[model samples]
Target: MTKQLASSAPDLPHLDLPHMGQVDDPWGGVGEGRLFTGAWVQARGGVIEVKEPATGRVLTLVGRAEAADVRAAAQAARVAQVDWAARAPTARAEVVEEAARVMGGMADTVVRWLMREAGSAGPKAQVEHQHALGFLRHAAAMGQEPQGHILASVPPRRSVAERVPLGVVGVIAPFNFPLVLALRAVAPALAAGNAVVLKPDPRTPVSGGFLIAQAFAAAGLPPGLLHVLPGGADVGQALCADPDIAMITFTGSTGAGRAVGELAGRHLKKVQLELGGKNALVILDDADIDLAARNAAWGAWLHQGQICMSTGRILVHHSLHDDLVTRLAAKARALPVGDPLDGVAIGPLIDPGQVARVDAIVQASVAAGARLVAGGTHDGRCYAPTVLAGVTPGMPAFDEEIFGPVAVVTAFADDDQAVDLANRGQYGLAAGVIGANVDRAVRLGARLRTGHLHINDQTVVAEPQAPFGGMGASGNGSRISGPANWDEFTTWRWTTVQPTAPAYPY
Candidate 1:
């Protein structure tokens, strides 16, 4: 049996709740009890509600829309976008900038809701909230500038390319990254002058939709320009299939992403799918076992391993496999698990379903002759950080994206075998190789099929300038936060202003 550390939940730092400011709690004046009541949605005709995953607490109610309602919301956004698109680029940028400012100031407020709703721990939740705000700020500061070009001197023919928005975008955000990922989609779409109807995860509507709506409203965006549709798969599928929705930017499972793609394809609409990842972490025999173990634990357990870029698979050299697993299990056990806001090192799975999923995967893996090396039990929504060894190629744990507090360890006899084991998974999102030989690791990294690879590092670190997304089943198209992302969200239209007489039609 894995030793359970005496549940010493860390002392979370004090945070003043309802940081939405006096008399301006976007929920309603801060003193108003109505905001906490389950009436906010009814008030907005069923838009959304804030549900805490740990205790099933309801923080705020919001619009719980249906298919027709989502369609109407999209139509409303389309109509509102007509004027929004006509606004000067500077004017549009101002709204997003103001949103960024508001979001920055309200980081505590958003983090509180994120902790409550998503069961994200203190520091990571705070970081993700800040990331969301930063992305919005950076997005606001970016825009398309004319880099006009002269065409070849073929008669009077001339052409120049200029970027333009894609009208209206339908944003379907994921549960694990309720706030940050939503902003990842919404900010760029808005910055590019597209109207967006945001469909936040129903499980975390408060943090994703309600809080964001408050920021947008404070930032002075048109009321209907950033419509919030808070509902379940039905609502999301409806939004995906809606013809008026010009583009779909979604972050979720591979299965769900595929469904979104098929639907969008049927409509001939562009879809950006940031889907599932079964990332690999290769531990070379020459690497520092302690360092690799710590990094691997962090990569696998952060967000309970729910993040798309998490290293779900670890291929260790047979020479160091036993030592690494022991170190990893100890490190994982040291992580505190409790109330997300209480500054524990880790928190619960996003919801009960996620917990169940994790439990099921762990059980299935163990039954298939895999060793349950550490931390596999569940307490309500909370799942202790887990590690599995002896996981083989034929097992479901190796084949599936185990979005939970579980890391499957397998040993490789040599570098070639390690690389082959890492590449065995169907999904190729992110991978890591920890080795002393940087040159050899780099060469081996090239051979890995993942979109992004980290040599002697964790796979999930996000830099604003880094191009972030995956290949194959992980993502379609792409979404990166830098200038690359700007390029993705824009369409270059070719135009020519006659500097001289036009050519006659032949």
Candidate 2:
């Protein structure tokens, strides 16, 4: 912990964090910490003040990095990657496993920071921490798995193929699920024998990037192998343009993902992108209205609907459309909305800009003939959980990705219409179907063109061992998590040997 300071600006409120025993001043030392080249150094680009969205309070200052800083970090990673890749797989796995243990021990501290910095509720923070830990452990175990394959060759010859790391991987993580998203790429990259340069969202530098660096350092990972640079798009651009960065793994908006993909393509660097989604949740006439409402509420309102796979569109059978909307509106109104530290279901948006964006979308939808069932209001940075009915296919409310606590409902005539609506979107990230007939729901799910489909479940679901990604504009062809990640972070090389010299045809 470092010395705490008060906000000098009168408009900025005082910091108020949850009380966790013996974990005083979670924001302390944040401004002074920049993990580079195996050491915590001060940022030369100055500092940025992080504010808690729940109260508009200045939480702490974080060191900001610029292009020079990014270049330095990349150079350091390049230098360290050789030794990191040279180590035995078992030895690397042990270090990652130890890091997971250390992170689990600091769960309380990490959760508090997540709530304060990222505006994540207590439950959401817990989920992020648990997922991060699980992924870290899984990655450690994967380190010892087979990395190559043996293939039959011509007579008296042998052939083999092995997966190799892509030197230095640059990971740009989003603010929504900062901790888990960053670690999802970092853990696998490390396990596959690649060094990493992480650029966490500037808005959540402390909880998103700094904490992971601390845990890995404490777990005795060789210094310089991992670097956390907390900065904005300029830093990210620098990272992508760096000649030494062999690959880029990014999680953010589709627009931003396209820019990254383009830059990486121009540079001939491997890139993996997990972008936005306008996911849908369908309710059949035979479904239990209460269960459907509950699932819809949880899927649409969790983390204020910031998740990429949040159910943004709800398609219901015309027979049950009105009933489902009524029940869902009630569920939305009943949810607690307030400060994240207090364990509320709906917390503040990441910033005023987001609140304005969501509010504007809701207002526009209403003007465009969508009926507001409940919510559709904002107080400070907090937007109420909103439900809108009569949403049509062409409206922005139905067509766009509203990254907020907003759910749009549209009625469909039959299963064909429902599946058609689900598959109509350009984004094919995820979708959910709820029905009494499980077989029917599964059949419909098969027809929908989505990367992931849930029968009687919400779209917002992920496990560390599941192959998670999207199709079309939602993401690139690459997938992350589980064994699929190994393919993305590594390259394949084929080797061959002969027992005796053979004459060349030439």
Best of the candidates, lDDT:
2
**Per-residue accuracy of model 2 over 8-109 as CA lDDT, tens digit each:** 111212222211011215434333433344676777887777778898776676667888987888888888899989988888999999999999987777
Of candidate 1, the 10-residue stretch with the lowest lDDT total is 1-10
Runs off by more than 4 Å, candidate 2: 1-35, 500-506
- Winning model by TM-score: 2
User: How many pairs in model 2 have backbone atoms within 3 A of each other, for residues 3 or more apart or on separate chains, i.e. clashes?
Assistant: 0
The TM-score that candidate 1 achieves is: 0.89
What's the C-alpha lDDT at position 245 in model 1? 85
- Which ranges in model 1 have alpha carbons more than 4 Å from their true place? 1-49, 144-157, 499-506
How well is each residue in 151-268 modelled by candidate 1, as lDDT tens digits? 6656455666667777788989988988888887788788778888888887776677767777887788886778777778887788778878888888899999999999888889
What C-alpha lDDT, on a 0 to 100 scale, does residue 232 get in candidate 2? 82
**Candidate 2 has which clashing residue pairs, if any?**
none
